[model samples]
Target: MTSGTADSGRVRSGLRGAAWLLPAAIVLVALNFRGPIVAPAPVIGDIRADLGMTATVAGLLTTIPVLCFALATPFASWVIARFTAERAVSLSLVIVLVGTVVRSIPHEAALLIGTAVIGIGITIGNVVIPVVIRRDTSPERVGLVTGVYTSALNIGSMTTSLGTAPIAAAWGWPIAIAVWGVLALIAAAAWTYTVGAGAAWRGSDHDSEPLPVTGPIDQVLDTGSVRTATEQRAAVIETLPHPAKRWVTWGLMLAFGGQAFSYYALTAWIPTLLHDEIGFDTASSGASSSVFQILAVVGALGVPVLANRFRPRVIIVLVAFFWLAMPLGLLIAPQLWLLWSVLGGAAQGGGITIIFIVIVRLVSNDDDARRMSAFVQGGGYLLGSAGPLVAGALHGATGGWTAPLLTVLVAVLLLGVVGSVSARKVR
Candidate 1:
């Protein structure tokens, strides 16, 4: 056969191979995003004693990462634009690996600095994964893959939260927190292998541009026309409204902020709330909180199934109801903590999934996807990073769970209102 025919065969082979491997790689990477942040929480007292830090400083271990999620988003967007999504993922994993090792070094300064580095690394992953999902997955499968991706995030959080304190007991908190880096290293190697294999088959070195199905060979073979087409597309995008100016974008940002605020606040203090309000012991309270984290997987997976049958607005309303029920249920009937936790868990998980789905559906292309994801997540996390602190402060001031639960209820109300407005059909 001719050279053109041979090249086509190689491209097709690469596509088929990537179809399965890509999603697996995405899931693996997802598993690392939240695990590292939550790992230190279960062993915070040990960590504080070991490092000689006060409670406020120790709290930064988790807070720093959420702040980084907001602060580093613009930088994350730039990295994706500079390097391809595949290379960005590899770089993020490497950064996470290095940060994990640094945090395990048994020094207070190292622990704090290392936590910041991990946050920065995870920020990059947060921005890119959605872009990769939007670019690689077929239109029909985007919702399914997004759900799986979000669900994996919860699984990681649940795994680390439930497992860390025991591991710390056996081997020390440093080792307990550091062990998660192994997963990041494995994911990096797997992702790097896929990128290399695809590059070899496609026979290209430039990773700056998104290629059509046939790959970068087309650009190499027809540089002038490809450049013109790219320029034209950019010009068209320029003519449209900026992402910042769009009402839907702002609505989604608020929706995400409310979701993040509720999730982080609850994750940080649900055990304490249960102990104080429901009279559960320390161990029981901790175990009960796990119910909230683990049930998120169900919520994440359920959103896609609901999407198949209902309009986006209907799903948003339903999720909002669940979110509203959690705070109200906790305030009115603390006896049913289990039931409220399950509903709240599902609401948080489904809330994030639906926002992601709306983002991917609303954007016109990969560049738009990157920018929009960064904008929404950056704003959302900035608001979210305040959740735990605010909840703690309210509890301290009022000396009751009632005030904090009311605060959470207000945030959920914002979520329902803005989420409904955001989900309205775009004309």
Candidate 2:
């Protein structure tokens, strides 16, 4: 074989190897994103009692992260511009580590401060990772990679939520909370290596041809480094016209908000629902809640594969059914709460994956996907932040679960309508 061909082949092989490492690193980062947030929820009772915190104050521990996710996602691209995606994510891990250690100090002030810091770190990771995946992976593999990413997120959440109670019982809640920091540190290390290797690969393959830009969004992704992020945004805006006007973007946002609304509402109240409404004991209630998170991993892994193969609308309908079934089942058949929990978890995981795939498909290029993802997540999550509070209010006003379950049913119906629109083909 000719030396030129051989050199070209080696470069291709090196790029392929680096691509594999990138996904692994991405998965590790995904795992840490939710584990830290999930850990505190399972040990919240202990935290509240030990710290002498009011229920209102303790609720902020969970609410702060969701709030940050909504508020911080818009500006995530700015961070990506400042440090690059890799460095920003690695810096986020450092923030997470610091937060974990501070919260473990066994002080009320430290716990609140640390949790908010970790939330900020998680918010950046959440917004930037989709853009990273889109830029890094081949088009056909985006769905699969998203599936794995979502699955890793659910797995981390499940691990901490289930393990935290047991670990805290054996050691202490502070230690249980701090243990996840070790995983964050490990993720940061993997990301650092991935960034260094990716840079080297880019330098070596400088002669390789760039991916063809099919549209405005593709043009945005192509700006890997053309001066500042401000310039990048200005360029994207100039080319793309009106991103917000697209019906699909709005549909995607509503669907995204619907899923977030249901997930957060249930996450905040499911254990209590199991205990008070379903007649489960304290331990059983927590265990049942953990099962919901565990089963969600199954949906996260399976749904994307199905969405890729079958009609996207069919999957949306299926997700809507899951959403509808959960609240109806809880309301009508309290005896089978376990089944409802599984359905709810599956619906949440699968629904999230479906929305992500929709976002990826909605835009053909990395830039649009990044901006679209930012808007969908940023605006959607901001709208969704009210779900838990609204549900709580409904429950209080009625002094029962009926009003809350009905409220979830209305949200689920909206998900079906908006999600169906999002599943349609767009130019």
Candidate 3:
């Protein structure tokens, strides 16, 4: 072949290689999001004893980051509009790295501050990663991309839950927790090169243009072209309807909120619940949580497949029942920890996946997805953050596990009610 043909072949090869990197970067960044939050749980007892922290303050360790997720959602969209998904995610990873290191300082104040910083980073990644998937992946591959990223989240949580205690026993909890920062650093570096450079390769089209950050959901509704705020709102209201006016969307948002609240509450306290209430040792408690997260990975991957076969709402209702079984089993028969963990993990993994899938399908296009996601996640996380705090305080005041388990049950019931409405077939 001639020289030009050889050069063309090299370019094609390069593009093919680059294609793999984007998904890898997405999965890697996703992996970093949950591990930091989950890491402290396995060793939470040690932290509390060492720091002389009460149950309520220890619960704040988990609550602070979740609250950040709530506060960071809208701002994530604005940051993406200003900096693009690539840069936003890169900066997020950096923040996570710094937070992880700072939290390792082994002081009460540093721990809280660092955890909050990591939460901010994770929240930004949570908002932008989906947008990046939509923009970068082909229409046919979107489902696969979504599944991959979601699975990575569970994998991160599982790894941290299972491994932290062992590592802590060997070295110390501080070292075990802080080591995750290295993963964050690696993800940040890869994202800076792959996502940033890849965005440049895709050219300066509408996808490259900065979205109008301020407005009444105008630009978010129209992906075709920029329009005046009024024109965009009229067009969106005509086609999609505002989140406030759409009862179904609100239902979906509440469903999302309920699931989030339940998941965070369980994760924050499951180890303690197993150890304190049921008389399991620390290692056993951590292993139980590991089981919960392991099954979560299965649920995340499996739910989307079932969704293709079943009505999304039916699947969601079934998932809600599984979630209910978690606290109910704990209340009625504490020995069935294994069964409850499996059920809860599967419910959480599948439920979260289904909720996001519903959000994406509810919208007409990518722009609509961004707006709906922002509203749902921003509001849902704020609602969810309260779960851990309230549960901890209840446990502190009551001196028993009854109230906290009841709280989990209530959240599950609310999730089912709203999820049913959101899952109804749209005409």
Candidate 4:
């Protein structure tokens, strides 16, 4: 066989051999994304006491990361374009590893700066992983893989929430928070190995070309005429609506925004809300709130199955029902907090997965995937960063949980309305 044909064969063989590794690496990297962020929360008191930080400054530890996820997204998109997705993943892990270590340095400045760096790293991974999924996975498996990807995120959050306090008790908060760096390090090493293996087998260091489009764009491009790659891309671009004008794009953004807003708002206040409203002690409230975190694994894994069986609109309705039910249920019946938490957790988890599934299915190429993912996530996170503050303010102003719960209820309603509109089948 000619060298070109032999090289092509080797590339395919290498990809097939390493297919399993990609998913494994994705899960491991995802574990680092949320674990480091949440790790400090369980020991925030320890950190505050050790570093002599005021409550406002202590709050920045978590707030900085969410802000980074929002404001740094465009930069994350640029990183993916500049460095190939594989390389970006490696770079992100390196940054996360470095940030984790820095955050353990026992200085308040180091703590805040390290959290920001970790947020930036996680932001890069957030943008690029969707690009990687779109580029590497088969069309049919996109939902399943996206589900797994999101599920890992929740697993990481839940794991860190549960484990950090005990570790802090045993060693100290810094060690407890710093220990997650091992996860980032291992994921980075594994991803680098896969990248090297693929390069070695393919005899090429370039980013893999975008997978062939199979939708309307594909039909438009494949007119049995010779066209340069640029011409084909131009043709595809002509067929699609402008990103700003597309209803699906805007709808997905709103849907994601509502989801994120609700999630952060609840996460910030649920334990306190439970304590105040239901007469639950601190320990019981915390354990109850964990139901919200742990049940997300179910929601994440279930979205793909629902996607396979139902229309996107149907899935959105189901997710919206649960999301809406949680706040309303909380407002009407504080005693049933556990049930509301379960529903809300599943809804939040499923909400994110379904939005991702739609993005993967709707975008025409890897470039579109990266841009759209960044756009949706960036907008969503920007709104989400305010959720806790707004809820807290409303609660303090009213001297009751009613107003805060009602605000979340309204957000959930908006989520359902826009999400259903967005889920309309694309022609």
Error of 4 at 182 (Å): 1.6
lDDT of 1 at 214: 33
After superposition on all C-alphas, the RMSD of every candidate to the true structure, in Å, is: 4.7, 4.3, 6.2, 4.1
> What is the C-alpha lDDT profile of model 4 across 1-427, one tens digit per residue?
6654444333433443467777787898888887787677667667878889865576566667777889999999999877778889998999999999999989999999999999999999988998888777765777888888998888887887777777778988889889989999889888888777766654554246332334455578664555665676678777766666776788888888888878877876776688788886544555577778888889998999989888888888899998887899998898998898888988888998988888888887666788889988888788777777777778878889999888888888878889888888832
Highest TM-score scorer: 1
Sort every candidate by TM-score, greatest first: 1, 2, 4, 3
Error of 3 at 162 (Å): 1.4
For residue 15, give model 2's deviation from the true position in Å. 6.7
- Which lDDT tens digits does candidate 3 get at residues 311-363? 88888888899989899998898789889989988888888888877776677
* lDDT by residue (tens digit), candidate 2, 102-197: 888899888888988887888788878887777677667878888888888888888887777788889998898888888998898898888878
When 2 and 3 are scored with TM-score, the better candidate is: 2
Q: How does each model score on lDDT?
A: 0.81, 0.76, 0.80, 0.80
Best by lDDT: 1
**lDDT score, candidate 4:** 0.80
Model 1: per-residue Cα lDDT over 1-427, one tens digit each: 6654554433432423357777777888999998888777666667777778865576677778889999999999999988778889888999998999999999999998999999999999999999888876776788888999999898888888777777777888889889999999889887887767666645553233343323333333443354454564465467556789998999999989998888888887776687778776644655677788888888898998888778777788899899888889989998998899899988888999999998988887677889899999999999888877788777877888888788888888888889888988832
Error of 1 at 133 (Å): 0.4
* Model 1 ranges off by over 4 Å: 1-17, 200-233, 278-285
Give residue 105's error in model 3 in angstroms: 1.0
Residue 168, model 4, lDDT: 75
